[model samples]
Target: MQLIGRDAETGVLEEFLGRVRAGESHAFALVGESGAGKTALLQHIAERASGCLVVRVEGVQPEADLAFAGLYQLLTQLPVRFDQLPAAHREALRTAAGMRPGSLNWLAISLAVRHILFAASDKQPLICLVDDEQWLDHASVHVLAFTARRLGTRPVGLVFASREPSSEIAGLPFLKLNGLTDSAARALLDSTLAAPVDPAVRDRIIADAHGNPLAILDIPDEPLGGFALPLVTKDEWHLDTLPDETRRLMQVAAADFVGDPVLVWRAADKLGIAARAANPAIEAGLLELDTLVRFRHPAMRRAAYWSATLPQRQEIHQALGDVTDQRTDPDRRAWHHAHATPGPQEAIAAELERCTVRAQSRGGLSAAAAFLERAAILTPEPAQRARRLFAAAAAKHDAGARNQALELVAAALAGPLSAGERAKAEQLRDQLRTATSLMDEVRRAVEAGGNTDEVCIESVLEAWRGVEPTTADDYAKAVLYNGIGRHDAARDAALRALHTPLVITELAEAAARTGHFDLVKALPDPVGDWASGIQARIDALLTEGAQADAHHRDSITYLDRTHVRIELARAHLLYGEWLRREHRRIDARAQLRTALEIFTSMGAEAFSTRAQRELRATGETARKRTQPNHNTLTAQETQVAQLARDGLSNPEIGTRLFISPRTVQYHLRKVFAKLDITSRTQLDRVMLG
Candidate 1:
């Protein structure tokens, strides 16, 4: 573990040397990331020093950030232990070291040496080496700062190599080395490693390493542009002492590419590790700041990340995921899910896999998409990847992201899928039709009310035209195509269902959502008539006094809970506007609050925000709420609206979202009404402006 790569660190060393040569003790802080040749640079400087006594001291972050752990090695060298220290002496050391008075540790001894070192500095040039300065604990930092401040007047020359900055040494002379430059990295790689690696490989390794010499050194020379360096001893690091806090922080950081600050805070809070302790860990260059926190060095990061068992990692991920899920932001949700350590591959993975399959089976393609996302995180095999891709394609199809859906299908097909999987993927591949037939049929099926016939379940064959498929029923096909922005196709699919006896309720809801409002409004019973239970719920909401019964509505079956919730929310929002138009501000406030609250409670923050914006626009105050799915967009509505807002007329929208011109208008009304803004102009403003 002798030092390496100090050729570039010469300027800082010369500055320190010159200051010492002038008979003035100097303090120079060398700041750099861990595994960036900082330690090697220090050793090189020490080797080159003449008549300079080198004293190397290392500091580390602690579980409590208490003083003394940082200067442990120095303290153990003290002549007097517990036996020779007087009470006043002990008290002074604790205070200087930032340690709890009664806490028994090496801090008192270290503080005593700290005093001695400064006194010696008055006599001769003494180079004090303190590594990992950022992790030195508050007390150590204070003591170092004090020493540095006074050293300029003494004979001591202090040099610190730090990868990160801290509040300490605010004005002291410090040299900061930010990993190697590209040219330096290229040369260093070429020198240290061997030949088979091409220029690109060298560049990639250099880029990935971010110029940390130590990290670069770890890549197998075989991979390092075919360069090979002689082997040294095993991974023996001089920084042998693993402070509990540092160890814990490193372990967590290793688990992800980088840890989220919010997530790190929440995790520390959950684990009961204090902020004081965790902050130092980050400042110490131990954590790589990424979407998730990780070790800055690839070697250290991998070591830390894989330290835990699969089960342990799973628990950590699950904890973080749960915490992040509580956040109403989709970005946060995705972030948390990204790092959720997969728990046991047993039921957790099985459950996720099943959820993905079932969502497809039931025509709840969006759910399939979401569940597949979770599954991908938990499972990494090609089979799982293919399945997840398939499910996501189905979901994208439902959402009207047709191109995106096709891409997902292609990805699934590209996988090393089994015969069944390949056949299914190929089948889906064959269905990329431009027809509006199936899209329309699915719309009408949704218009036909009832459990089995819910619009959410419309798997109309007509919608499946351009959509290639295998083994999937028309219902799955219709719903998926509609979901994927094939509104005209979705409408046609719904229409075909009119001739067959099927659940019209789901169909109407889907059609209504798809912007095929005419079809939705023309449906029978609970779906078509607001006087029916479906419409009655809204009428009752209008009559029942908004906000009085928050979350209270005629409970719709969870079968189409996602759709029903969207509808009820819209009605309530409309009712609030109606109340406001009538000068019932108080009533409007309550209704709007209720609507937003309901959406929020459902984890539909996007929708909740929409409702809140309306409330704000109308000058009605709304209570804070969190929901996941309240924002309204039928698969059809989403399609038509997307094209409509793009300046496409009803006919064009019909072609895009896959419905007729009439269907385009049908979805436009819902979009405008749901948005609580009058005119396509407003919709246009929302989209473009």
Candidate 2:
């Protein structure tokens, strides 16, 4: 049938292809329910993609257990010159494909895939289509997703069609395939039918199908009321009604996954089943018998395989296992044999455990986890099962399935683990918890401006103790040292973290405090309001009189527009000191008093004492404020206050902090109350300046 009801989606693809032809790379994902035209749309794009090197692979469900299976299929289609790649990348790809013996580095493989695609795209624009991405092997999908996201400026376009959306590829543009429009569904249904239907029956069918094209065309011949199945349920009811021999044949075909006719026929012959048994299923529009024994839909194969009794399924697996060529495909044979064995079998479990090692060697953490989990189920000994489960949990954790890893670890811990095993499992659990906790703490600290506190820094440092230091940790240390009046250490740390936007303000402050004016002058122009404020402060100290006055004014204005209260107060104090040197005692007193009031209220005694000293120089002894309010800015309130002062909308602030806009509004209410301000406009005068 001609593809229908996707003009907008097709237009997007056309434009995307146009861009690819113009030497800009792009990636897109097609997300939809089963049979909601993802495959059809992908094929449509491929057909229209003239002059492009199109490479496509359909993720086979049965092959998902095989490490790098989907990637192997894709690479085999490419005209890759392995010799052209960097030596490490070449070795990584060769090892992954079993062409060379070496440890598999998934990162190296991902990078190599990118190099290969970019090289190909230099000659001709490339279109890569992955159909049924949900069924792709975990390792292959990860590498492909990684490559797709990093394909900047290359003449390539990657399109993935999947029933379920994956977060790993969530960065790619997604076209969600909902049902066809009413008129379009009618046109499609009319095209499929040989005879005209009554209008009432037609409307009923349309409503039942919910505009799903597959359901509209494949509605059973029986009366609609008793035979209708939703798109989600698919054709399970129809599969159930087939003759017993046909159902058995369908099951056998389903079990011969990848739809290889030779495997299906061989297994059937062993079971003494005639090929004619497939006729009933083919007549029912559920099976397509040709060179490959295939199902009409992926759902149909699932229905066929699941419709069989456990014992019948086991028999089918055994028959398939007996016919499988072990020398050529030991993994498939072992998998089938494992399925055929009803209870725990040590030999089969050992074979599956060996498969885990092979999968792990290929950098297939998820596939290894699957094998280990299955082996655990098949291991007769409780201690061995516990150990296997723990190993699977570690693999799962490495694969980024955090919750599943936690559950598996908990299961392992509850079993009869030895002291060492139990300690290791508990450590894994602590690591998982700490991972999440540290992320939350860092986000909270950044948003709340609480990273300056000694207690907060110590807590984070303790949590991060044994981990290798990242650039982010360097940034954190910069902020920590700056807060503790360690300018030299802060400047060193800030220089190490100069690449990040958030470190710009800290770097400027630390460099200026340590008499490194030349360092600030050599830095790039600041972007954000806070960074500009700090930059202006540095400029003020390097200039004189009117220029100095203008820089200080600009510094205060810019600081007032950001969430950095401490920086803003520092700006006010610095400007006051400059005004004092200029003999503008009246202006200096105003600026110094404002700084002293804010610093004292926030319990920043050091800055407050400096402000008091500056005030004394201006012939005014500033009164000490009532002891600082213990109920000053809270964690969330401080974040909201800073963002609001910085001129961000509630929605934007909420998005930054991963909270709802209403929650942002609620936090803002508390912030305004804590800062003793009624409107955001007053934030600059009271908190920022």
Q: Can you give the TM-score per candidate against the true fold?
A: 0.31, 0.36
Poorly placed runs, candidate 2 (over 4 Å): 1-237, 359-363, 435-689
Q: Write the per-residue lDDT of candidate 2 for residues 346-429, one digit (tens) a residue.
A: 898888787665544432455566677777778888898899889888987886666778888988998999999998898787
Model 2 weakest 10-residue run by lDDT: 222-231
Candidate 1 per-residue lDDT, tens place, 1-689, comes to 33334554676687777777567878877777677666777777778777766677776656228654655554544333544556655676665456644654444444455566655544456677777777677656665676576654556677766767566765666677777777777777666653334443454456557788766777653212111111333433322355665655555444322244566667656765565654555666655444444444555555554555567565555555566544343333333344454432433445555544433433234444545555554555777777777866766676555566677888888887789878766655545322122333334334534434433432333222223344334454444444344556655665665544342333444564455555653324444332244554333333435542332233222112333434445455555655666676766665565556444433333345655776776774444432122145544355566776667888676455322354346457767766767777667666542
lDDT score for candidate 1 against the true structure: 0.53
lDDT of 1 at 98: 60
Clashing residue pairs in all predictions, respectively, total 117, 0
Local distance difference test, each candidate: 0.53, 0.73
Q: TM-score winner among the candidates?
A: 2
RMSD of each: 27.4, 24.3
Q: lDDT score, residue 682, model 1? A: 69
lDDT of 2 at 321: 81
